[model samples]
Target chain A: MMIPLADLVTILPELIVVSAACLLLVLDPITPSNKKDLLAWMSVATLGVCFVVTAGSMGDRVFAFSDLVVVDGYASFWKLLLYVVSAMTILLSIGYLKEERIDLAEFYGFVLLSLTGMMIMVSGADLLVIYLGIELMSISLYIMAGFKRFEAKSIESSAKYFILGAFSSGLLLYGISLIFGATGSTRLVEIAAAVDARGLDDSMILIALMLVIVGFGFKVAAVPFHMWTPDVYQGAPTSVTAFMAVASKAASFGAFLRVMLEGFGGMKPNWSGLILGVCILTLILGNLVAIVQTNVKRMLAYSSIAHAGYALIGLVVAGWVGTEAGVSAKGVSSMMLYLAVYSFMTLGAFSIVAILRRGGEEGEDLDDFTGLAKRHKGAAFLMLLFMVSLAGIPPTAGFIGKFYLFMAAVNAGLTWLAVVGLIFAAVSAFYYLRVVMVMYMREPSPDQEGETRLALSPTAFVVLALAAAGVILFGLYPWPLVSLTATAALP
Target chain B: MSVPVEFYMVLSGLVFIIGLVGVLVRKNLIIILLSIELMLNATNINFVAFSSHFGNLSGQVFVFFALTVAAAEVAVGLAIIIALYRHHASINVDDFRLLKW
Candidate 1:
């Protein structure tokens, strides 16, 4: 079969990323170890090119590969955000790998490869395509998570993530097969039409829906399926953790949102109730548990889980409004806005966690942050900004993201859900502020004195600056992002 | 005689349940990986059954993709397991608890 040029053009960004990754791997052998930064820069350049291409095609909606994939405003929106996130992650990793003494050029290659998966995921129009995309992404992540191969904790995290991730994919495949049996097609548009015509009473469809939710729930780190998150986040290389927390989560949610809104749109009444239960549980557990954690990474892990809960509110509202198109779009657009906001704050927060190397010891413990205001006022101020945003305080991106989601919930007549979310948001403030308190109010312990030093690398400084600017700029003026998401919402 | 679709569904469902139980209850890492394979094969079986029943090729095509993905997963899973084994001589899931269960 002859493939058309038009189909190839539709997937130009994916092709660019994949080929660049392959090129990087090929160039890795010839390039000396000290020059791995060259590979990193090359990867960043590749993302820059892909970014321009994706932005250029943002207005076009085209299906390619026999309708297996699509490129549209929605996919382009997520892809643009993902490119920025991945680029920042690569930039952050250059200094991190040197500091950690792990000089593997293939790390950048894997980032691009996994990014290729993510690009496919957000653009996937068929279930099989999405499944493949997820596998690609997860497989690369499993490898990246254990890049510090000698470290037992890192290896353990990789193994646990692998076992659980594969299990979840199996569950997802079973759900897909069942749904195929029910609907007779694996395409999202076809599935939506089938469910619409057949109605939602089929036991097979219901079971399939539950299985899909469970599958994606694990990917998104929702409650009950979030067991692997803290361990994985805490154990993986800090740069990898940041990427996973930001770009990977965005991609998973992108695919999840599409699969639900397009494949199972007709089953909104059914799924909204189940997702509501997950959301409340996630918020309660994530916020309360984060408050007690002493390690900052683990705390952020739980906090990421809590953020997932906030994002799920958008999904629940989207479903809760049932057949109402306008309200549902609000829900979807709010979800997009929340994720976009989340990428900035979470990436910024994790970058801080990544850079704070104090005299060869990682500043992972909350105690390491004591008297940060005195030691490095700039770092402390940035951390304060991120923590405040994370807690959803006024005049920060996090607050705006949550406000829009809550407004969406109220509009969908789920005012009680909004109230529950608000209560958790307030509860979340305790831990976020505790970080700020440690930075500002306390003095460094005598034992850690004189030996401690902050290694704020040049690239990390750039990332922090960009992330800070995004948090402040979007926080103060959200209309641009708001309108962007409005245009990108699914029809 | 051709097997009925219901029989295929029931058989695959039972296999899927058995595999899930193995993944959840088994302590050995290899057994868990094998269990995941079982779950994937169960899906493949269901897909083939439904494909023939629906008189369509998409489900069969998906089985091919699933098989390919399952193979890729094994490759990656075994590599990770090997890394885990190097860090600790044991392959038992209970033994590696440095990062809190």
Candidate 2:
């Protein structure tokens, strides 16, 4: 089969990233251990180039590969965020990998490869393409979660994630097959037309929709399906955890929202209620469970689950008021903005968790943060800011993200759901503030007296600085982000 | 002269449920991996059944991708199981509980 040049050009970003990943893998064995940072830098450079290439295609909608994938403002918006997150993950890992004595160049390659999967995921307009994209992304993550091969926890997390991930993808693929059988097409546009023509009474379509939701529910770490998150987050290397928490969730949300809104827009009444139930359960369970966690990583993992709940509100509203394209746009854009703001604060928090190690001792437990203010004011202060933002306190981007989501909910005549969200946001503050209190008020334990020094490598410092700047800058001036998301919202 | 599409769907659905149950009930890591493959192949069966019924090639094309991905997953899954076995000398899922909440 002859492929057209236009199709090739449309996927240039994905091609570039994949080739760079393969190059890094080939170079890994020959590259000396001392010079592994060079591979990370190369990955970051490749992401930078892909970012620009994707930006050039922004604002223009182009379908390629027989409409299997699309390049549009919506996809580009997520792609840009994924690139930035991937670059930060690589930079943060440079210091983290070395500190943990697991500095394999293949780690960087996996990051780029998984990012390529995410990029393809957001751009996929067809079910098969999206499935392939998700599989690609997931397989890399399963490997990255076990990058610390000698460590039992790391390998265990990898096994758990692989089993659950493959299982979920199977569910996803089954749903796709059912939908195809019902509609005789896998393209979102055709699926929508078929759904509209068939009306909302089709049991097959409803079953398929539920299965798809369950599949994506597992991917985004929503409650009842979030079993793997805490273990995986707590066990994986902190840098990889950050990547999974932010980039993976964002990509999943991007594809999830697309599939729901574009493919099943006509079935709003059916899905909105189900999603509302999920949103409330996630908010309650995610926030409530996070409070009892002793390990900081597990706490963040649950907190990330709660964050997914908050984003789900946008999805619910988008479906609730699906008849009005204008109102649904607000819901969609709000979700996108929420995930974007979420990316920064969560990444910053994990960066601090990754950096606080000293001489192979992991500083991941809540007690390890005691009296951090006295030991290292800068690191403590950064953590405090992230915790504050995460708690949805004012003068932070988290508050702005929440504000818009709630506003959309209220606009869609779901003020009660907004109240439920607000209550959970308040409940979430207890844990976020506990971290603040530990850093500032409590005393460092006797045995950990000299061991809590911050290992601030220059690359990690840059990551922290970037994340902090993003949180504060977007907090103060959200118009730029608001408008960017508004323009990127699906038409 | 040909098997009805509904029969294929029913057969695949049963296979899928069996795979899911195996994943939940099985204690061995390798068995769990094989269970996942069963689930994936169930979907592949559904796709092929639908593709032939509809006379559309896209569903068949999807099966190829699914097959490739399933193979990749097994490679990665076996490698991880090997790593876990190296440390614990066992492939029982219950043995790997150092990361519990």
What tens-digit string does per-residue lDDT give for candidate 2 at A1-491? 89999999999999999999999999999998778789999999999999999888789899999899999999999999999999999999988888899989999999999998999999999988898899999999999999988888888898889889988998888899889989999999999999999999999998999999999999999988999999999999999999999999999999999999889988888999999899899999999999999889999999999999999999988898433777789999999999999999999999999989755767899988999998899999999999999999989999999999999998888899999999999999999999999999998877878887777889999999999999999999999999999999986
B1-101 per-residue lDDT for model 2 (tens digits): 99999999999999999999999999998888888888988888988999999999988888898899889989988998888899999998887779883
Candidate 1 stretches with Cα past 4 Å from truth are: none
Q: Which stretches of candidate 2 lie over 4 Å from their true place?
A: A321-323
Error of 1 at A176 (Å): 0.3
What is the lDDT of every predicted structure here?
0.92, 0.93
lDDT of 1 by residue, A1-491 (tens): 89999999999899999999999999999998777789999999999999999998887789998889999899999999999999999998888888887768999999999999999999999999999999999999999999999889888988988998999999999999999999999999999999999998999999999999999999999998999999999999899999998888999999999999899988888898899899999999999999999999999999999999999999998888443789889999999999999999999999898888777756888988898888889989999999999999989999999999999999988999899999999999999999999999999878877655666789989999999999999999999999999999886
Q: Residue pairs in steric clash, candidate 2?
A: none
Single out the weakest 10-residue window by summed lDDT for candidate 2 chain A.
A319-328
Residue-level lDDT for B59 in candidate 1: 88
Model-by-model DockQ, in order: 0.93, 0.81
Fnat, one value per model: 0.96, 0.81
Interface RMSD of each: 0.6, 1.1
